[model samples]
Target: MSRSGVAMSRRTRLDSELVRRGLARSREQAVAAITAGRVLVGGIPATKAATVVDGSTSIAVTKGDDPGYASRGAHKLLGAFEAFGVPAPGPEPGPGAEIPRSTGPTLVVAGRRCLDVGASTGGFTDVLLRYGAGTVVAVDVGYGQLLWRLRCDPRVRVLDRTNARNLTPAEIGDRVDLVVGDLSFISLALVLPALRACAVPDADFVLLVKPQFEVGRERLGPGGVVRDTALHAEAVHDVAASAAMLDLGVRGVTASPLPGPAGNVEYLLWLAAGAPPLDADVLAGAIAAGPAGPGRRA
Candidate 1:
């Protein structure tokens, strides 16, 4: 059903499709997640779980919108840790490699104070807690959105109706050791300054980068997806450059094991205070690897 007069394929409900694809374990879980706005179709947020979609339409679960793991996004962070070798979780990429995997010392969080931005449903917070973080300050722009379980947990300090752009060390009581963020809608450029302000002089960070939100609207294509590889590269480059300006050293950039809702390819940009930004060649190499498909395993 297009101007070309091509026949349209059959459509299915978002929740049912999730179960059909094994993206969700059960219909009830799918419905709960979808109703919570955790599902996206064709790069746009689906308003209803029952919305119909055709084969050409790509549907994906929003990161951190899972019924389990505090948020579906917890898996994404765990993958980042393993891939980035945060606390050295997996194999280290060889020299001259575009991205390094599994190479950091086991920097466990037994005594680390943490900050979770875009702490929607406390997905990242959950990960920190599971790793034995000392304290977790969860910040989000919405109210009553965090699951009651985490909202009431002693280890989690919920700061609802708060914006990362306005965050302060005073608000958090102290600078943090670990800062993990999974934000949406806003560009990283806008939030990095606030993060810089709230982080300890040497805080380590792992931030989720959604290209659709970072790339200018002009760079986006139909359905708000940024399909052009060059545009994708530029999106990440711009974010890295912004961090450089703030003196946050680049650790590495890797394709997320999970894509953004609506199937937009996303990345995890790791940084730390006082470390050097990655050389241009290394940056370019990572870009050449591209973010178009299921990328190399970290």
Candidate 2:
């Protein structure tokens, strides 16, 4: 309790608290508002990257409207679905499964189970459900970061404070047809095996590749953002190589529709188990050309 007669305790990360309480749609949006000098900590402007503050501090945002989903990550995946022709999963016939259907021959998630790695604020989970996924096991290392809207969603299974790198198939209880990851800070190589364990043969994967994390520490600029075009290409190559090592085929790579925190450029890659992956030249060409824009409609 403060002298102002406010109960302030249980310090929490500003970004996560914003999502959990429905003040923001996603942690990315909260970070955006905070970085833009829009977020208030105890009625004062805050700009730190990750600040722990009392939940009762009367946090407010100068921004007028909140995001459409819990996190900006949703828009990134939405871009892939639009660019690559991935469609919504089909209706659930009965109790437990959902199948996906595409307008063309593109693979769908109509009746597939999914795992959302780094499911903070449940933005990806939210997208998965909206596309009619029967069930999405949303996992994040941080606790209580999932938005109430996502938490209340019957199709999403919230797994807070759980690291995807440590996950096992037994923990998930069934093989999944799709796996999507938007992980940060760690190398994808370390977590790919864990995610692979959860996927059934022929399952597809969509991963957000953050060059800042994939490149060597020396390549990163201030605030941990990657900016060099060469570095971006190298990072993508590293991820492609790693996927190949796992016997996962990289079908395609596309730039994210949205820039990451601090305006870092990012890429999204689609991989399928047992299918032939994209060649190095193809991956490099995609990077050079940039994400297939809205002009390349799905």
Question: What TM-score, computed on C-alpha atoms, does each candidate reach?
Answer: 0.69, 0.69
- Return the lDDT, model 2, position 7: 77
- Per-candidate RMSD, Å: 11.4, 14.5
Tell me the spans in candidate 1 whose CA falls farther than 4 Å from its real position.
1-67, 87-108, 284-298
Which lDDT tens digits does candidate 2 get at residues 99-191?
434333254665579999999888788777767788999899999989998889877787888899999888777878889999998988888
Instruction: List runs of model 2 lying over 4 Å from the truth.
Output: 1-67, 88-105, 291-298
Error of 2 at 66 (Å): 10
Candidate 1 at 162: error in angstroms?
Answer: 0.4
